[model samples]
Target chain A: MVNMLSIKNLHAGIEEKNILKGLDLTINPGEVHAIMGPNGAGKSTLGYVLSGRDGYEVTEGEATLNGQDLLDMEIEERAVAGLFLAFQYPVEIPGVSNMVFMKESVNAARIARGQEEYTAGEFLKLAKEACKQVQLPLDFLKRGVNEGFSGGEKKRNEIMQMILLQPSICFLDETDSGLDVDALKTVADGVNSQRSPERSFVVVTHYQRLLDYIKPDFVHILADGKIIKSGDASLALKIENEGYGFLGLNYVEEKA
Target chain B: MSQWLEDVIAHAEQPASNELAATWLAEQRNSSLKKLKEQKWPTRRTEAWANTSLVSVESRNAKPTPANITSWDKPAIPGLDSIDIYFVGGQLKTDLSTFTLPEGLSIYTLQDEKAEAVAASRFAQIKPERHIFGLINDAIANSGVVIDVAENAIIDTPIRLIHLANDGVENHSRVLVNVAKHAKVTIIEHGVGEEDSVNTSMSEFDVADNATLYHYRFALFTQKALHVGGCHFQVGASSYINSTIVAFGSDLSKLNIDVNYTGEHSNVDINAMYLLAEGEAFDLQSTIEHAVPNGTSNEKVHGIIGDRARANFGGRIHIHRDAQKTLAQLNNRNLLLSRRALINTKPELEIYADDVRCAHGATIAEIDDESLYYLLTRGIPRSQALIMLNFGFIQELINDIEIDPIRAWLTDMLSTRFKSMEVS
Candidate 1:
């Protein structure tokens, strides 16, 4: 099977600190990869690097999507290439409406792939349907992007965008942190419905609860900017029960 | 040489320009012209022109020359239909004038003696120590748009004042708009021209009791022109006024938007935008006077500077000693798109009333990188995203532009003016 994403010897960091050092991971299509890590173990940095955040410098190794060189592309080009990342801390844009932002984004990706941009009516139809799937209210589309949303609402909004965008490979960085049970279920369902043999998902989480709901095919444990263990979904249980300290790693700083 | 100034003032014979003024108004214009000759041209030493240059005004000739209108061409201003008026060099282009005055409203150029005298007396309480251009507008304003919005008449359409400059010679012009009690109307002053020749202009606005006005101005000009204009608003009891000024060019431009809430419960909202690029210079000096009790005023201005361009904003909010519950706020923010660009913003609040709420702030900085990258991650091209971010910064206030035609016109001008800026 062709791998949907491949990261090898990835050494990335912001400023002087190397947050993601010598990290190697491979994600195949149809697989849900759950990355569980200690607080500063490069989990979020990895997500940012994959999405091409400006400040994070990628020093070593290479990351590729399908067979294309992903690390070398610009941020927007990478997004057009089917990379979608749900940020851990979403920024609030004061004046651009969510609907306008969504439509522009959808058409931008479509145009990059030689597809015609969606008409206003078509864009609204798709946006409305996605909002329903994520259980977001209709009025959410009228307000500025993430301007006045609550924490859970913001998370649901991100998932709603993911549904509308429908990228080939999606990255959810701590998307479940602020969600309530109902919101979490809606988000999980939104993700599950998009699962297909040709699509892949990378879910970076802080708790084992999201894993129970997400049902990942593989689980990876990361510490000290590197992934130390990888196994089937059961690996999440060992880490959840043993608390990561048993791996000869001082995860006390992470737990604190 | 046929005297250009004589030809400019002899615009009365043009039927198109004199369509609105009454017979008596034409007679009053002669007296006003006599008055204009008595005053000397204003200079930078004056209090109002403190931060501006007076080179254009000092160099302009004041003389008697036989007129010839044959060589002049009709000028064009984008979104011309929005207003009805013949433009000046800042002189009136008599051949291209039109007037479709709404009911209970009348417009007359001071060139008409009878109409000029009637305007002078009827609105005598609203004048502010007439300047040289004001005198010119009064004496020789052979073409001026006079608006007398009837009491309680709600005008749904915006009356546009289109000023087009047609000659390579100096010209001066003026605008006077009066709204009666309980009347509602919006007068848009769209100033767009490229005159290698210089020009000076003024607009005096009056709003009576319980009236409302949305006065918007768009000045996109060339370095050869210098816009030293003034806008005086005399607000009556319980009236509301919103003023928006968008300035893009001028070798030197100074707009003093003065608002006086003369009666109780009057309110004023002033918002302006200035985009200075290349070697152009732009400045907006605003003064808000809360003269009566419970008067409120708010001012917001944004400047976008690039290359060697410069922008200056001096916003002053004053609250009278007896005025209580006066809420005033002034904020000015600028983005320096180039390191060579310079901008100076002064936010001043003078509150003699102890119970007033007056606050002002100014900030200048570059666009945030995180914001740039965030948009990029959403698949917006870097350049496109930068434009979006800039647009987004001003979207909240810009969304208030009610007329579709004007809104579209503003968008078109903004997009076309900035080469690297994209609208789609």
Candidate 2:
């Protein structure tokens, strides 16, 4: 069995501050990995570095997706290569309708992969089904992309895009942070419905509540730019009860 | 002063044998020529023309006579339905035009005795001395249109005016619109031409009490063309007026628009959008005066400049002491796509009334990188992402357009323009 995502000795930072120092992680196909850490443990930085976000410099790292060099690809090219990053804070793009944005994104990715493009009708059908699955109103398709959307709606929109793109490696960067109980379930169900033998997800969150909905096969405790410990799903339950104190790590709230 | 001013005065001194030109038109023309000669051409030293330079147009002589324009294909705006009035080389093409006036609406050329008389009587409403372009237009304009809408009448369709400029010709055009009390109408003016041409045009609108007018102007000249135009509006009591100007594709263009509220409780909304690329220059000066009490006005100007293109926006809102309870707002937003592109935006508010609400704002910024990155993360290429963001910035004003076909047509035109800029 091959690893869908592999990172070793990964070091990244923004500006002069180093966030991820010598971080190592592996996400095998069909496995859901949760990364829980104390505030400044570089959880989000790891996700951003993997997704090629600007300002997040990867000083020393080896990251691959399906054995391909992820560091060498452009931001959009990385997206085209079946890497999806559901942003914690999705951006608001006014005037570009959600339907148009989704169509262009899906078609661009497909064209980049040398696959057949989706017709308008076909794309509409697929988008409608995806919206239904995410429990979002169909009228949202006509509105601007994430413009004036509520917090929960934005999260659901991210999941909707994730489902539509059907990436091989998914990075859920705190998707459950601001969502309510119902929204969390809706997002979890959307992720579960798309789960396949060839799909993998790296779910990063501070709380273990999301793990109750989307069961993870492995739990990693990241601190000070590196993963210090790894265990099974039971380890997340232990952290939820005892917090990071049991691991002898001080928990300072990350100011972002 | 440059030779263009002398040529303009010489052209105005020539005599004509028309009955309409013998009365007030002749005196007004003489007075405007005197004013133009005394004032000379506006330069950077002038306060109003501080940010705009007319050096390029100072030396070019005006074409006194209308060019002999041959028969050409009738111009059409995709998805627009209107009563078409066509002009070629500053000459009205009555043969190629079609006008079917509905009840209480009349359209006539300035050559008609009755129309010229009507225009002459209303000539005092617009002060040509305020602008050099207006003065020149008033002195040499030979072809124009006069439209009158009767009281309580509402024209459902827009009246379209199309002007096609001839190569190396200096064209002067004028438009006079009179709307009676409780009447409503819409007018759309478009200019399209090829080659090097100089055009100076003026439009005066008289909106009566309780009447409404929607005026839209689109200046789509060629790269080598220079356009100078003016719009003067006198809004009456309780009337409503809305105006939008979209300017693009001119080597150097300047538009001066002024609105005066003569009656209480009138409302005016003015919006303008301009796109310039590849060494193009555009200047827009708009002034809204709340001369009477209980008037409301809003002005917005947006521009996108790219590739060393230059743009200027001067928005002025004036509230007189008698204009109490007036509510006025002015905003100018500009986006520069390249480091070389330059934009000068100024919002001026002169208020003497103690009990009025007046506010103004101006902003010039490049495209937001965070927004660009957000789009890029969605698998959209850099160029396509830029085009999307640029269009999105101007979509607010586009949404204000009530007509569906015109809105769709403008969206298509703007997207095409964005793509061309990206290519260059």
Candidate 3:
């Protein structure tokens, strides 16, 4: 059982503030890992660091996707190397249509992997199916990317991209934060449909409601930039029942 | 006076070889020349021309030459089926042109006796007090066109005006469009010039009551060429007028557009897009005036500048005291592709009417890094992402074009320009 994504002593920070302090995690293929944490626990920072976003410097750490160093690659390079981060707040681009953006993204990834590019007709066919799967109308493809979209729709749009790109490692950063029950279920179902033996997922959430639908194989409680506790699915249920207070964890800010 | 002003006056005085000028036209040209002699060319000292300089155009030393009508192939615009009219070296090429005017629509050269009367009347309406370029164009224009659409007539095909200039020559042309009451028409003015040539053109539109007019201008020239042009609109009661100007490729280009609502309930839409790269300079000065009540006007200008290019946009909207219920909006949005690229945009709204709704906004910005990163996270490279964002910025206005062929041609032109810029 090889680890699809491995992070060891991942000390990452934004500007001068250390957020991810000495974090360590290993996600194996076909496994869903949920990272639950209290407020300011660096849950979103972990996702940003993994996807190679700017402003997040990995001070001292090792992060790899299938043994390839992720921290050394450009943002687009990391994306082509099978790392996808579902942003908590998807950006609204006013002029680029969803269809055009998706086609370009898909083709760029394919070309990077030495695969043949999809023709317009072929891309349209695939995008239509993906839109249907996400319960988004086909007309959404013609509109600007996420422009004037509802919160639930944006979350679902992120899922649609993840499904289309089919990256080996997916990071969902607080995707369920503003979603209602129906939206949550839809997003969870979309994630479930993409679960495969060769794919891995890192679901970062502050609440345990999403974990109930996705059913992560491992649950890690992140506190103060590190995973302070690790357990099976029952840990989530326990945290939902007793809250982070019951764990008796003291969150001390780490100085760089 | 400067050498440029002297040369311009000399060029205007030596004209009239093509045909006998009508009495009204001769008077108009004489008055314009008198005004030109009294005033020098617009310089940086002028408020409207502060961001633009005429030094390059003045130094070109291009003189008005006799018409060198060469046998040339008809220019083709992809996806466009239009009545093509060609003017080469500032002279109308009737043998090379092809057009069959439908009933109720008439087209003629300014030299024709039938067109001279209408041209003279329209020429008299242009005020030469402020616009030096308009005065210069009227004083020395060697070739021009007059198009008239009869009352209640609707012409489906666009009337295309193609002006091609050769090097070391000054090409001055004019166009007069008269849309009768309850009529509809579209006109496309396309200009291309060789390196180091100078092009000065002016077009006037008379839109009558209950009439609609669509005017599109595409100016593409070499890097060494200079383009100076103007478009004026007189909109009547309940009439609708739409004009779009697309400027790409030139050393120095300046366009002055004026729209005046003469009757109540008249509406005007003025939109322009300029794409400049590598030593290019473009300046647009537009004014929309609402004289009567219930007038509406909208003006939008978008610019993309790259590689030391400079773009200037000045839009002014005026509502008179009696022009109550006037709704006017002016917006100028610019995107700078490189650090050295410069953009100067100003939107001015002067409303004397208490009940008018007039708003103006101007913004100059580079592509957002967050948006670029968002696209990069989806596997698109930085360069491609920039192109997408840049295109998207201009596409907002391009999408409003209802003509399929014209829209397609513009999209192709923009993409080609983008690709060329990427390589350089």
Q: By TM-score, who's the top model here? A: 3
> How many backbone clashes does every candidate have?
22, 0, 0
Best of the two (1, 2) by DockQ: 2
Over all chains combined, what TM-score does candidate 3 have? 0.85
- Cα lDDT listed for each candidate: 0.74, 0.84, 0.85
Write model 1 residue lDDT over B359-392, tens digit each, in one string.
Answer: 8899887777776777788898777777777754
Docking class of 2: medium
Q: Please give the lDDT score at residue B58 for candidate 1.
A: 49
- Candidate 2's C-alpha lDDT? 0.84
Provide the lowest-lDDT 10-residue window in model 3 chain B: B15-24
Residue B381 of model 1, lDDT score:
78
- Alpha-carbon RMSD, each predicted model: 5.9, 4.3, 4.1
The true-versus-predicted C-alpha distance at residue B190 of model 1, in Å, is 2.3
Ranking by DockQ: 3, 2, 1
Which candidate would rank higher by TM-score, 1 or 3? Answer: 3
RMSD of 3: 4.1
Off-target runs (Cα >4 Å) in candidate 3 are A1-3, A7-25, A36-42, A57-63, A67-73, A93-157, A176-189, A206-213, A219-249, A253-256, B15-24, B67-75, B96-99, B338-340, B380-390, B415-424
lDDT of 2 by residue, B30-121 (tens): 77777777775667889878877677677777676778888655656687888888776778776423555789998877666666646777
Task: State the TM-score, rounded to 2 decimals, of chain A in model 1.
Answer: 0.96
B309-335: candidate 3 lDDT, tens digit per residue: 888888888889999999999999888
